[model samples]
Target chain A: MPDAPLISVRELSKQFRTFKRREGVWGAIQNLVKRDYRTVQAVDRVTFEIQRGDMVGYIGPNGAGKSTTIKMLTGILVPTGGEIHSNGYVPWKQRRQYVKTIGVVFGQRTQLWWDIAVIESFKLLRKIYDVPQRDYDERMELFNAVLKLNDYLHTPVRKLSLGERMRCDLAAALLHNPPILFLDEPTIGLDVVAKDHIRQFLKEINQRYRTTVLLTTHDLDDIEELCKRIMIIDHGRLLYDGPLALLKQKLLRTKQVKFVVKDSEQAARIAVLEKDGRKIEAVDHLTYRIVFDRAEVSTAELLRQILAEVEVRDLLIEDEPIEEIVKRIYAGEALKEVSA
Target chain B: MGPGVRKHVELLVAYAVQFIKVRLAYRADFLISTGASMLATAFAFGFLVVLFQKVPQLAGWKFEEVLFLYGFSLIPFGLFNVVSLNLYNFGNDFIIEGKFDRVLLRPVASLYQVIFEVFRIESLHEVVVGLLGVWLAASRLKLAWGPLEFVLLFFFALCGAVIYVAIFLMLTCVSFWVEDRVGVHPPVWNLIAFGRYPLSIYSGFVQFLLSWIIPFGFATYYPSVRLLGRPEFRVYAWLVPVVAATFLTMAIALWNRGVREYSSTGS
Candidate 1:
């Protein structure tokens, strides 16, 4: 049991039935007597397991069932089908006991009292979660050291800036030392510096306390910077769940290397020296760009051959942008689903 | 009590303390609102005074008796206002705006959290107003005052408050099934006005509706009658506790059903 996954979900699904309304006042009147309803499958048979110490990024477009999945896992929304077992309890059934082991933060909403000082909210939360006084003091010291919350600890939540409030909110969630942390866009609507500060705090908590963090974010940098494993969900279905490096490699096989040469004739010579799924193109007479599968031809070998043939002035190597692959996923282009 | 119950009680007290602290932050706003409510209570008492001038008694009940009933009713009504008035906004603020998600996320009972999150200290003035009315009426009527009578009066007040809370709690649970923000509470809440005067003043059907259906009679009129030593209403007076318990049980059942609905549909 100790080796069991901290969170396990099997064939989970949620369907919402909404009253469909027609356009204009006439439709509103007709809707009183007779109603039209539509059912939307918000989450469909998503199956995944999260280990105790893993920081996993859950990414999807808006309304792509990311929140729905998170809600089910957090025991906020009961699934219409399937079963979920987290921390040895069925999430929705034993919600009170299950929630004791998990902490959640929604970026757009605050759990703090708006008019109270930040420290008072923390004190109240300490009592609500029944955290030991010694643990509370220790966590406060740690959060203050890492998050620098002492700067705005006495400020009312309404008076604090977005970054300051977010820091306090993060500290509030960790006051109980919950084993699992669920963050819904925890760094949304913040400047680069603020976002980096939160990411650093999250990384510190995950490493220092071994807290399992499941983060859902629209910000791809959150995934690239924090997550070793990323899950791609689109239109209620989970398309991919595996290592980030494997996803980048499997979806876009070719790595592009740009070379700017002193001689113009070498550009033409390089374009025709293509074989397999490798090709070289001339941006102009003096520059050549080589596109080759990294698995088939290593970047160092390709660069060595090109350098030996021509006196290269400058060169740049770039992997396929994750944005390109994500956009393709959003556009309904199918990639063979990857499971971890 | 068991440790589990003690822990929840401690949490409830903590929630109440935080709520009162927040309310006290706006001292001027609290004073103005409390003053306004007291003024409204004064107007209600004034209307009764003006009515007594036109008629010596209402439906064979003297002005002193009616005043006592009105005062007694406010004791429980005020208690309900102080504790559970937020139930009136359960649908609009909690459900429609999706704030209930926060309530459910915590490691406590959702209903307990909802009940204590806000305290209407401003409405405490209504209970003061009720005490003043009772004092003034008892002096005028020269009623026999004893330890048993005072204890029974206190007991009735507690029962009245529970009944009112149960009634509103049941109405509030309707929001879980029907997503309307306005909900079905207002019309039912306005019906508390019937219990202010003597039930004899209303027709037979209104009397039945108040006695058996909503049971506002057990909260106010019957208790007032028993306090006055009316042999006719003696049986009804003892039924107050039973009525209160039955309604509270039903309200809690409805609340559990509503919570189940909320978890399943997430509305």
Candidate 2:
């Protein structure tokens, strides 16, 4: 039982049937009797598992079913087909009891009462989740220390700044000390400083309490900084699921190397070698940049070729940026490379 | 009581206290709304007085008897107002706007949280006004307050409130499918306008609709008739409890289905 995954999902799918409205008056009138409904497959057979202490990032483009998957996992929306067992409880069926074992935060919305003070909302959460007084106090202290909620804890939620409110929301979700945490864009629209604070707090909690976190975020830095593994979903299908490094390595076929040469003559000599998806550009009189497909040519061979032909002073090698890799994945280009 | 029930009760009390504090913070708004509600109730009473001046009786019912019926109807209406006006917003605020996500995130039942989240303290004026109208009508009609009558009145008011709650709950459930902000509750809600007067005033079909179909009449008319020592409606008066239980069961079943069909908006 201990070796079993803490959160397991098997072939989960959700299809939403929306009424397709028509254009003109005739179509509208016809819709009243024999309506037309179009079904959208929001989540298609998404399957993954998370260990008790693992922080996993669930990322996708807009309308890519990240929120739908998170919603199903959190028991807010039922899955049309498939199985989800978080802590051995079927989320939708055993909602009232299952929800007690997990905490969820939707970044776009605050669970806290708008008109009440931030502390009051926390207090309400404490009662709703039935947190022990001693435990509540301890968690509040820790959250205050890490999240820096002291300044706006007494202010009404509507009056707090976005960063302050997001911090309070994170604290509220944790007060119950749920073993599993589901966050959908928890750091959305936050400044860099606030985003760092939230990411730090998330990391600390995941390590200290062994809280299993399933985070869905558009912020790539959140994934880069916190998640060791990530699942990429798009068009309702799980595109890629593996270690973050492996995903980066798998999706990126090209590497860039910038070198400082002796003169424009060395740069011109290197520019002639541009072939087969490899392009060389001159920066100035003594510097040149070479982009080569890693599959066709290794970094060492390229370096050797450059060193053998030209007088190379200094060089730096860099992998493709994660943003571009993610963009390619979302646009359905990475699927071909990933499968191959 | 069990721990689970006790926890819910404690939470309800906490929400009520917090809501009162929030209401108190906006004293001017509270005072204006409360005064407006009082004036509305008085206007209703004033209409009744003017009508009695025009006609000695309505459909063989005296002004005092009709007043008692109107007052009795308010008991359930007030109860529904306090707890369930929020249900009217389920489609727009919770479903379309995705605020229901917060409710489902909690460990409590969704309905329980929604009902208590925004307790309408201001609507308690309806119950106070109802009590005043009942007291005034009872004095004018010289209605005796026997133990059976008092107990019957309590059940009538309680069951009557349950009926309205059930009806509104079913109406609110329509939002789960329709996905519209403006609910299908208003037209049905206006049906309550007929329940305060005697069913005899309406045509036979409307009476049948009130008695059997929608059943708001059982909440006010049948119970009032039976309380006034009218033997004809005694059987219908006892059926009030039965009607309430049946409708509530249907409403809860519908609500459960609605929850299952809940497809949350894209975030």
Candidate 3:
């Protein structure tokens, strides 16, 4: 009905069995005779669908199976159970053919050869993907215009700065013009300026080409700036999946409202308005800060009550920061699980 | 040729061109490494000559026959070194360092991509010296060559190269499970070094080990002996292609299993 949503993953799961060894010499010798292994559920029945042209962020804490899920989607790792159908192809089963339809960039690793020039690496990828000469030239031109790659096109990849290498990598991945792109921490170690450049390029490609992008990153700024839909996974389980705005609204409801009153008498009267669940603190003799849950007390109603009580000179209302919201979400989930 | 095969060949050639360019950029290192390989081959040949001077024949084989076998062994070894040398780095660079994920992400078979990614042009010196050694021995021995013998020589060399590659692939695939253990190349190289001499000189077990266990003999000794018109070992010579195909299949199977077992390191 809705173009079948470009990527469909149904209850995909991955489990790993890792050997456990002891610390000392005796334990090492004992390990040879009788080995012990523990099974870890790295990704457990994670399910989500991504529509065409949607930029979705996949996020989690360390060892939360974010990379494992990305690897499965990119056909690098076979899922231990369940199914994944991206563009009508089962990723791991039809790996070689499926990979031709997608591009992947793991931030910590460069797909290009270390000693080769950026252009040489792109040419090699062209041959590898069998992209026609005309298409290759067109893509290179477009990438040069958008990514400003002409500056370091002839420089070897090893000599390029991190930001330059990442830009070239993004161009190389897209040279084949794949309809889907998977970026795992694509801006992991980049500075603020470089991160902005990569995010802008990704947003453009996703919009212009209708490319389905599934990005996994730790930097909240990356998620805030690029992703519209956010999926949070923890302990191999998907905890939240929906619009980023909705997630903020659901987990974060408190807003801070600061009022600058004309006199100390007005401030004292406003501080008395904190009788309900709202909290009021005296910043100085002239200013009063009120922290209230927007869901419980509407900002308009609070303003009305304040005006009815005393005359206010200036007032400012601010929503909770995304960083604080995300921290609370993680901490809340973690604490509840421990207590349970 | 099918379009798929043609594309793969083109990709391989493209990769080779880049690799050559990279090697050329470090001209001094390239020359030194190539010269070192040539000098090592000469030293091995010089040792054989000195040993032959002290004795008319060793292990029921003449000096010329042994020299031919030695040279014949290098052909496949050199080709393997040039084409599949990265197999030796599977444990360290690919597995332990988690670089194998890049190979899997490509739109080609991982084995095919890894095999053709880098061509060590410096190793070509081994092939040249090997061919020279074989020709010198053949001329000195006054061996007669018919068209069929020439065809057989080429066929055996190809089969020998396949066997060598198969063995290399199998050993390197061990990294998929072991993670990092310095790889199996060093011991495999030592075993291959034995093939430069007549298997007849070794004990019964050593000969069996070379002939069947690891099949180093099929790569060099049996092929060389058959080319020299020796009928006694001709029975084993017929098994060359059969053994090569079997080992190659096993190697691929092992590699796939290793890929499955690969618990990729790092986030």
Candidate 4:
């Protein structure tokens, strides 16, 4: 049979009514006697789907309901309205069974036993998940091989480095061989090398086990490397969804070039080219930035043009950043803000 | 559900192993903590005995009998510290640090995970010495023991454990909403200090309240009386824990409701 979607959510929403607070103990004391409540629409009517083995990035700014959406998808939070069918089970409704088929990693925390060796934590999980002895042994061997857990299998989690702790956390979450993994900020606060290690491992896992991954991360590299599709939500609403390439195509076609020109006269002419404004950005004197839109002029062609106009020593080019795209999306832009 | 003991024993042992291993890693701190706990409990119980040595009976029970109440109270209270102390603090760290989301990812019961994470050995020494005190007091009383009577006493002592766990479980469940008991809960150590002794000494209304409402009698007095061969409390043998477990179950249901609230709002 062809692959059915591993996760299908329809119109899931969550709202929280919070108490309005003033200040001081007296104000808190006042809350005890008489109450006030304000309602916050945390996750507003979000719906999406993920097929088996598809790695997708679920991203939004702070308070954009990113974590809330992940929570609902993981069956930790029940939606105020809507239907969710995942891995042939209704998550929150059949929690005991549903959780068995998924793993989750929260980057800011450690899930292993704090004082015990890493392997001990895995063994405990083995019993908790009830994986048979042989299966557990095999998985343990494989995890140790891939994660290099042998180096710290006997070290208490508290002693592990931040990167090592995250590795152990990932290993602990997956010991059950769950079909899907939910990773929230799994590379937050890590050094670049550490982040790359984790991202590469995640990619391998997704390919090898066909683990459908739903990731919420601050690092765009995580999205760029692992997720084939991107979903952006803001103010509790789903803003965009589709292929990463499609997302990149719509908004920005130019790689911006920045350089320090040696000649002031050359800078003036560059500004003239820039004011043409079709897709050129050149500032005179100290810093000159030239916008090179791919649809307008080839990057090499723009470089040749800039070379003829000015004696350029140092320069830099930048692809349109995801953060910038998200900013515009949050600014309530329509689909027509194409930089190219 | 799935061979309860068969499943839980190994896991609980794992928890113990981890707890002890952690304690061992901090050997100096463990030694100091153990000493401090033993000293504090000894002084407190000793002071109580001195204050009441001149009296005929405290709350209508003799000195040794009061020790029985005190002794039985420790088992469940100690067991609770070992099992659920981290669960009491989970609401704070889980929310502030956002670790609750990680817990939701696991394939086990949330309640089980919460309770299993902590292993508090700080107060365990107190309970051990307290049990010894009970044995000494029992010997001085020169009470004749029958096979059936001894079994009943043992079973009744187990009920004290049940009652303490039941109350603790209920209170910890309340933490999801209130979050801080250091401010909100009443000064039970002073007001319900009568619970540490026999409940028979309190007024009729107070006795009824402690026995049925707060159910502290199940933790101390009811079991003490049954061991004392008091006919009035003989029926409490079966009733204490069965009745208290019902209350415990209600607390657990309330905990479920609280977990749902947290998972939804994520505040």
DockQ of 4: 0.65
Higher DockQ: candidate 3 or 4? Answer: 4
Q: Is the docking of candidate 4 incorrect, acceptable, medium or high quality?
A: medium
- Please give, for every candidate in the order listed, the TM-score of chain B alone compared with the true chain B: 0.96, 0.95, 0.95, 0.87
User: Who is ahead in TM-score, 1 or 4?
Assistant: 1
TM-score for each model:
0.90, 0.90, 0.90, 0.89
The lDDT values for all models are 0.87, 0.87, 0.85, 0.75
Clashing pairs in 4: A281-A289, A281-A291
Which structure is stronger by TM-score: 2 or 4? 2
lDDT of 2 by residue, A1-340 (tens): 3689999999999988777777676975676677777789999998988898999999999999998998889888888899999999999888989999998888999989999999988988899989999999999999999998998888999998888989998899899999999999999999999999999999999989999999999989999999999899999999988889988877887788999987666666776566566667777778778877788888998888878888888999988778888998887684665544
RMSD of 4: 3.7
Quote the lDDT for B223 in model 3. Answer: 89
- Candidate 1 backbone collisions, by pair: none
DockQ of 2: 0.54
For DockQ, the strongest prediction is: 4
TM-score of 4: 0.89
Report the error of model 4 at residue A5, Å.
Answer: 1.0
